[model samples]
Target: MVIAWEDGHRSSYSGESLRWACPCAECRGEAGSPGRLARVQSLEADELRVQNVALVGQYALQIAFESGHSTGLYTFGLLRSMCDCPECRARKSAT
Candidate 1:
């Protein structure tokens, strides 16, 4: 997916990377416990298939995958940080 930031910077990400970075409780966990994704040995193709996307108020997006996982609330800030475009990469490395 591609995001056109208000600053006119465009950021892009692939479905595979997004699925790998899922921040849901099941994927990221809580109380210092390891998440399910962390314990998984491999990812199925369906798990990385983006089925739908929904806006959450004005700050985040909730994405659903074909594998039936949809609890990740990807905030704008997090999404920005995840951008791997050359500009974003350079900016991050310079910091």
Candidate 2:
């Protein structure tokens, strides 16, 4: 699945990563737990390359990064809301 940040940057992630990165408390945790990415720093452009993408049934996306980060499940809605591209900015501005 495609994971977009809040800075007009887009990256492809696997279904595994997608599910792992789920913001829902059920998947990650409540609010202070490690969740999927506990000590994971924001991904850099060089590391945004999608190594693999796996679909977990029809619920989540698992994304493996070239940097060996394969624990961030990205949901479809989350992916859409995470779109931080210029297009999104323009759309927001227009709105």
Candidate 3:
């Protein structure tokens, strides 16, 4: 899926990266465990491809990555809510 930033810049991420970055408890954690990538030593390039994208009802996009992981379903609203640009700005301001 294509993520459009507030700054008018858009980044196209594969389903794998999106899945790896899932906020779900199955892949990550409900109590906010950092993420699966946090445990990986290094990622191979072939692991970063979008295998499939299924629309979960009318709420979320269920993405499968090339690494054979398919669990987190990202909602459109949730994606917008979890935007890193604003969070990054806030972090910079605080620091």
Candidate 4:
């Protein structure tokens, strides 16, 4: 998905990456718990792309992946933090 931030910056994310980064309790585990990084796990080729997308009450995105797993809601803050552009990546690394 592609997002235009309030700061006039744009970011894009892959279906698989977003799925892996799912913030749902079932995917990421209970809040404050540790064991959430599933985006780097092994996944089928079809799960690497997005099929459809929906907005969630102006706060998040409900993406339907080709894999049929569409329960996660990605918030704007999380999406912004997931940016993989060169500048974002550099900023992340420096932090």
Q: Write the per-residue lDDT of candidate 2 for residues 1-95, one digit (tens) a residue.
A: 55554666775545444433556454466656765345555545535567777877766666666767666676666676555567766887898
Tell me the tens digit of each residue's lDDT in model 3 across 1-95. 67765667554555444655776666565566656666776566655677787889978878777777677788877666545566545875798
The numbered model that scores best in TM-score is 1
Clashing pairs in 3: none
- Badly placed stretches (over 4 Å) of model 4 are 31-41
lDDT of 4: 0.81
Candidate 1: segments with Cα more than 4 A from true spot: none
Best by lDDT: 1
Weakest 10 consecutive residues of candidate 1 by summed lDDT: 12-21
How many clashes (backbone N, Cα, C below 3 Å) per candidate?
Answer: 0, 21, 0, 1
Best-to-worst ranking by TM-score: 1, 4, 3, 2
Score each candidate by Cα lDDT.
Answer: 0.92, 0.59, 0.66, 0.81
What overall lDDT, based on C-alpha atoms, would model 2 receive against the true structure?
0.59
* Model 4 lDDT per residue over 41-82, tens place: 577777767888899998998888787877888888889989
Error of 4 at 28 (Å): 1.9
